[model samples]
Target: MSKVDADTQSKWDEQLDYKKLPDWKDCASILNKRCQYLEARDSKQIRSEQCVKTFNKNSSTKPTIVNPHRPQTSLAANQRSCILCRDLNHSITNCKKFLELSVMDRFWKTKKLGLCLNCLVKGHSVSRCPSSYKCKTCEQAHHSLLHRTQPADTNSGIDTPSDTSGQSTSAATHSAMEKEQVPEAQVILATALLLIKDSSEGFQLGRVLLDSGSQVNFINEKFANSLGLRKHRKNVDIVGIGVTETKIKYQTQSTIRSRYSNFEISLEFLVAPSITGYQPEASLNVSSWNLPSNLELADENFNQPSQIDLLLGAEAFFDLLESGQIKLGEGLPSLQQTALGWIVSGRYKSKYNTTKKASCVANTLEVGLDKYFEKFFEFEEIQGLRSIWSEEQNECEKHFIDTIKMLPSGRLMVQLPFKKHPSCLGGSYDIAFRRFLSLERRLSKNASIKSQYSDFLKEYERLGHMSLVPNPNLDEDHYYLLHQYVLRPDSVSTKLRVVFDASCCTSSQISLNGILMVGPTIQDELLIILLRFRLYRYALTADIVKMYRQFLVNPSDRKLQFILWRENEPTPIQTYQLNTLSSVFG
Candidate 1:
């Protein structure tokens, strides 16, 4: 026994008071709190030590593994497993079974289980007969004597019982119950996802959202374009609690869409803002926003594509939470049918799943090295290719056509940056790709690679390498150079002729040549027109967005210009793209 528990028991014996004596539960509660603090502290220390070891090991081992070291720009911090379903040797896929375990198993393992008479194991009264005897081999007379001492009448039942005849079992059986919510202020109340069936039609993924605080809500852009709602635009600022700075760039646009040629409707949720925001203004009709949920995924198997319209999301639901139509605590008291026409209770505890999904998801999303888990969340395609990445096809062709990253072996890996469904990572390959690329197998599998590389030409970008590090060496005021001066808003000849001088002597740096009326570039042409009405001296405003991010030097080229942030730190290869801009006065 723990020293504290032993002391507590001694005090209880001497005081002859059960209330004064800390029971196993009370002692355990105290220990649990202490253990939590200790575990957190130890985890931090272990992580630190591992970091140091990682450096030392890198010194002796392969340092910037060429392909592996390539910087990857991910929006999230290391992935997090579902707190409730992470370590129960099961995933959310199997979470339903978690509820069948003892209450303690459920609490520590998943939200599925609750503290109850079932887990307490002492739910019935001793006089209930069968429990009075300790063994099946015991004499029936002995068992009967033990149970008979107590009168069968209610008055006696209510009164003090005879000695060693009756005992209180579960406080839960006859008492009220209360369960508190998780301690996070930002919690998801409900979520919905959708699929656009064709250019003109939309279908509901058999779901709608009723809560707020969801990370992201999406709609198919293709669906939006077909609906012809493109002309209507909604630019909403995502402000408020827990919003990231990058979200300022998101602007909402609308489009019209429909489902089945016969079932034409409009869909507009698919436009992703450049930046995602918290209090972000989502595009919605608000009061009139509704979807036809009559069409569910024809295939219960999530592997195949679903014929759906728009996935109801943060736009429609977050607005509802502020109005209090949605409650955060208990699964709703009543089950409501979706517009798609099915009985679905907000009681989202997956009862229909034969296998637990929680464990499957948690184990799959686990960050560290474990091939089985990493691929658990990934899906296989028609020919049984586990990932879209096929070595038989070559680098550019690996991802069918939509260019995603590649493992060393050249395979596609899908991570759902904004998935909030009950079964977040379910089914097979066809669905995993839907988060980023369209799943239509139209036009030979090679259609995606050409556009992927061509998009870079649209901008005068340089850092091409910063997609991997936490910080970068690029400076500000350089991004303005990315746009190739095309044409001015007003028709006029620009006097400024530009010169570009860049070198790899240190890090890639550029110096622009300045002169007016010498060249007819877009910037110069615009300057010439503006000068017509204004004085010779003009206000030259210059700004750089993500300067450091734009100049990412790939790890392989790090020795040339990438400098270390610390003496022993892993040669901090920059991750996200940072940019820089500069301009000269005439």
Candidate 2:
């Protein structure tokens, strides 16, 4: 194990070479021949008789040698309290109370003391005792087998404790029921890596928490839905410490395989909400749930998802525990067995640390497409909508520029404007432009992306979303600007969309025309909307197609939304101005 040990072993090996020695039988023969040669002694010594006398003397042995100076017993050794009589200065065997008892009574007393019948010692029974003494009754090594006494009927005349309150049996039952209804521990949660077996996917890696006290196993709704699991609706009440009168409204059947002990089991799980009331004490705090190091889980949506999923529960836990399929270690309070494959609980030493608030730039998705759909669609309906949007493009961009051109702009028009624009938004144009160029190059080779972008541009051009301006018509009267493009793969439409930043900088000065725009908020304040939704049994939800592009700007404000555009890499660049509010206007 260590360099020192290895060197020591090598040095020890150099002292002997067994391979160079004589064969076993040959060596034995040589030894025998030497013994025969020494068999004869000098005639005056009477060698044969002398040899017999020497052998007989050595054959008979005495008790093993011990220190001659040490006493047989010490004051400290004798002072320990006797395990049997609870007395000092002597052990259980030599107790005066034990000696005074009858033989049969002593046997029962020894049994009560849980001592080794053979050695008359505590800590071990006769079967495992090292004593060589045989049973006094049967002359067998096991003292328990030879000693038999009829069991006493101690409860024959014993009366059960009666309630002093004179309550009826039903009332007593109610009191007992009340005690049983409440439990001490909320849930014993064990997080382990598991192998889940699916009909289509044989064994996939999963992180699960086994709840030994629960009546049924639970799977996270989000995780289950991701796996495309089929569900059956059921309203099952869940009663626990600090839990509300709540119910699990769904159930699903699935098979989970644990390779920890090479075991697999199929069962139906009540699809409970994995995210319940957050209790700092009830959750495991770890860097990530993935087994070993979690670098592999970087691409996944959850580095540490719900701590409770696949609760083994009372129904399954006891069976596995008894069969030796699940082994628990007390030192680290870890569980190891087959459930997901050989898995041990991860290190959960720290308290739950609340995540920090993200910076402004990281909050780009605050008013994103994902957020808009979540506000309107129900759980299952969102899935269907996403599937459709992924393959289809909207047609509402056809009239944006046309409508903007028709709007009258005169000296009489009132301007609602801000004095200062947000300077932080100005420096990102070059980076966004480079990203757009990279996306365009990727789209050139990808048919799906190319077709999706083509359909998007077709609708935008047909709707007059932008109007081209000749190079000669460019004037100092308007501030020339450019909008960057963004590729949102997570969205339903994985196409490149232009990002219009009206706050774009021109030579470190804010654009006066850009400052003259005011946008109307379409989404309602969320708190009030949520309160109203909860009050209605039936409510209508609608999403306007091409939501932002549907709103048109005045012809006077269109020039402030100008951008440089080229149809192809070799084509002459042209100036174009957007006529509708794009995604960034939010």
Candidate 3:
């Protein structure tokens, strides 16, 4: 009651009769209902007043009655205003002030106003702008006002004949003269020479860029390969300026250490084909400029253009900064102390008067609407219309037909259809050993699963489907398949199934399945098979046990299907070759 407003309380008190006062509980409920109604009424009145004020500000004339049926349209119209002039009378597209500005000036104004270049609107960035409007001049996603006209003779000068009339030549020369020229300034980016750990357990000097703006670190693919670092597969989309998109397939981890100091840190970086174009753009003459002699510079040749091998993101940037800093004269780069060394960055005036073009580089990631629609339509394609055989598939089938042989025991043996020679597969023993250790730990937790899995492998060996390698140290091209078991409690036949992973990648980042050609589908679809089963007068169904084991793999191909196994803890782990057809292959 004390919290209620005075006007509402007074109205409620007047409504009560002294001779016939209601019960205490009923009176409380009535008061609560009255307070709610009053609060809602006040909110509605405040909103209406705000709306009327907005309408009055946008409209120069007296307020007119807004039709209830079309209130939304009137409100939307009143809310519309010119982004450039902030005038409610017209939108930015129709604003005369915006159209009068020069092309370069319009671009700067749009950036300064924080308006979307695509739609010329505020509140959202160009990358996230929903409007699909494109420039009429170039059909780009930016507004027409931002499009720049190119000079005619820039690329077509050689195409013109020498016999052309002087008037035509003079017009071409005039167009080239009208082209804009801007002075070039040398800008130094923060870079350092750091030691990065390689696959051989040695450190190598690599050029690194320090960027506090990036959220994730990146490494150059060529540099990463030079270091011989093992990369793990990771699919990530990288977006850049103007919402341009790219993808990274691999990432690697390594330790970085300062060359002059003992400061060391480990980092994970996504591997990109290239971080960016060479830094500094061109060489700079530093004879006239003065720099501190006592400072240990991060990069000795910061003024020279060089490839960036790595980019340290914000996660490592802040930690490397120190309190020490030195500021030079105006139009000169300043020095900031860091873990690596003193980093020189900022603007630097050059003595050369040559004209050069400037460009902006930004890395961002975004999935556009077109990509989603493309993926959605991909699933809608008719699979039956697609060609069944390709060049590689035909070659694979021919190889199988030529190499296949029948054994004396009435079993067919076929060679694995490889896309390339098997020598490309590097060492896979370590990878397989780690996976086997992991499987052991998982099976240790469940005794019943462990027992069933061991029995299945023992049964497979008893059937002569696999055999132990005579010498595991044989110097030959080999691949190891990672094995695991799958459990099915409801199954009436086999309760456990041993599954081999042929897609496990080695140090070379190449898997056995990656090099092998997947044969075309020869089996009918399940729907067709079921429909045919119903048409028969009588149906008989049977499942073939160990169907894959019925066919044998060639002696040469068996080496590629090696596996690590042990029957129990007392037994030593031994390498075995699968002599029969593996389920991983069709």
Give the Cα-based TM-score of candidate 2 against the true structure.
Answer: 0.27
lDDT of 1 by residue, 1-48 (tens): 333456454644454444442345654565576667666676666546
* Per-residue accuracy of model 2 over 439-510 as CA lDDT, tens digit each: 568667877666656566556767888777665233334544544456787777535775555555555455
> lDDT of each prediction vs. the true structure?
0.28, 0.47, 0.74
> How much is 505 displaced in model 1, in angstroms?
40
Per-model RMSD to reference: 29.6, 28.3, 22.0
Highest-scoring model, TM-score = 3
User: What is the total number of backbone clashes in candidate 3?
Assistant: 2
- Model 1 bad stretches (over 4 Å): 1-106, 109-195, 198-206, 210-240, 244-372, 375-586
lDDT score at residue 484, model 2, on the 0-100 scale = 46
The CA lDDT at 579 in model 1 is 19
* TM-score of candidate 3 relative to the true fold: 0.38
Where does candidate 3 stray beyond 4 Å? 1-100, 103-232, 235-361, 366-395, 406-411, 417-442, 462-464, 467-482, 486-496, 501-547, 555-566, 571-577, 584-586
Worst 10-residue lDDT window, candidate 1: 356-365
TM-scores, each model vs. reference: 0.22, 0.27, 0.38
